[model samples]
Target: MSEGPLDDLDRRIVHSLQQNARKTSASEIAEQAGVSASTVRNRIQNLEAAGILTGYRPEVNYEAASYQLQTLIVCTAPVPEREVLAKKALEVPGVVAVREIMTGTENVHVEAIGSDGDDLSRIGRDLDEIGLEVVDEDLIRNEYECAFHGFDVKDV
Candidate 1:
């Protein structure tokens, strides 16, 4: 990791990975970024070491996987206990993700997947027991993502 900000090469590598990490190869990214494959590999390693490249995750289709219900459980926790409660929520069965928002009310947003309504109800009860007030629950239909445009390389 360099002490300075990411250079053009670093930005290009990150942008390429963000678009598709599973299908893209180091050689392919190297060609697009006008660098050698080894350089691309080295850069990726450095990025990971610096914590700039944290993780690569697969996009899952819960419905296709037989998890018929995808839910967003919005909750409110005491401001001082928000972070702790958010972490505890993740331990509950069916809980897939938990986000702690920096707000007074509705500060914890939890994403959960369940086979049916009963499963969701159980998860909600578990969250409540952990001190989170279940404010709302909505069915999640879809999600979309894109690479950050700031990482796009400018034509020189």
Candidate 2:
């Protein structure tokens, strides 16, 4: 991704923040990014105001939270009704994340979590209940812990 007005120092601060947002301090961020602490603080605040920095959150253990599964459900629906389908998909429980991906096969990628196998199964069932034309579905059993990493949690 292209860095808009973010200089080298700003980029460094962003990278460090992305690695661990909650624990990163302005002074520490400045040291890592090679800038003044105030600069780091101001930049972060500015980014937040611009909707670039969303919020700081800890990486919670899903298993500890009773969430034990992750599945990437690749789905296809009518192109004209894509917005409607996306809206309906959001209502399904256990669906933590959803994206309208541009791919050769599917138009949507749903990243969801469930309490167990049966919970994930219900996610698929719920989608069907809402009338989404699921051409195919792929469920990956999250055996170990998992983390979400994307630009949504960071800016370039």
Candidate 3:
């Protein structure tokens, strides 16, 4: 994934924004990058238009919502059914994130957040019903104690 003609200044701007998307202003970014605020804004818009900046999402403290249970699930499936399986996994309640990995066995990994043990169990059973072979489940003990953040998955 080649980037545009992004100099060190551009990289710094991007990195700073990635750290704190909402709090960091264009003026602040420009000051940090030693550029004008308008320049920073223009560069950001360009990056977004080029699909380099996908989205801006707010970071949340899931513990406040009682999002206690967290688990990492590995899903295995035939190559041809990869997309279908992934779609089904998305429909599974409490599943937070899913990724198609490079490993030959499991085609996708699902991160599920739930309220309790029963909620996690329900998600697991739902995944199984859709023919997603569950290879592993690593439960996270303290979800509220965890700092939760989202990512802007740039096209890379």
Candidate 4:
């Protein structure tokens, strides 16, 4: 694992994995980067060891999975306690993800999936019980993601 900063090859590997980690193979990425398969594999291991490459998670379609409602709950917690509260929020049923923002008001954002309004209400109450003040919420209709272009090879 040679380290100073990520070189061009490293960036190209990351970009390719970000595009589709589940489907893309080391040989394919190596071919695109003009490197060997083992090189690509070692780079991926080093990236993970350095905490640059995190876990690979599937993109789930909650609505299609019979969880009809996807809600984004915006809440506020004391800045000092925000991180702790965010972790606690995850323990609540239906809560899928939580983000702690830097601002004072509406500093915590929680993503939750439920079957209906009742499920959302239950989650909201649970959050409140854990000391988060629910400020606002909205139904999440869609989401999208793309690989970072800064890591892309110009001619790939």
Q: lDDT for model 2, on a 0 to 1 scale?
A: 0.71
Clashes of each: 0, 0, 0, 0
TM-score on alpha carbons, each prediction: 0.93, 0.76, 0.81, 0.94
Q: Per-residue alpha-carbon lDDT of model 1 for 1-156, expressed as tens digits?
A: 222478888988888899999998999988887789999999999999999999999999999999999999999999989999999998999999999999669999999999999999999999999999999999999988999987877563
Candidate 1: global Cα-lDDT? 0.92
Instruction: Tell me which residue pairs clash in candidate 4.
Output: none
lDDT of each: 0.92, 0.71, 0.76, 0.93
> Model 1 Cα displacement at 20 (Å)?
0.6
Using lDDT as the measure, the top candidate is 4
- 57-116 per-residue lDDT for model 3 (tens digits): 876556677887678988898888877788779988788778877669888899898888
User: What is the per-residue lDDT of model 4 for residues 4-64, given as tens digits with 9 covering 90 to 100?
Assistant: 5788888888998899999999999999888899999999999999999989999999999
Model 1 misses residue 136 by how many Å? Answer: 0.7
What local lDDT does model 3 show for residue 46? 88
Model 4: lDDT to the true structure: 0.93
Please report, as a residue range, the 10-residue window in candidate 2 with the lowest summed lDDT.
145-154
* Number of the top TM-score candidate: 4
lDDT of 2 by residue, 1-156 (tens): 444675556566566677677777899977755678999889888878878678777665677787767778877766776678878899899886677765555787777788888887788888777766566666664445323333232343
Residue 129 lDDT, candidate 3, scale 0-100? 91
RMSD of each: 2.3, 4.7, 5.6, 2.4
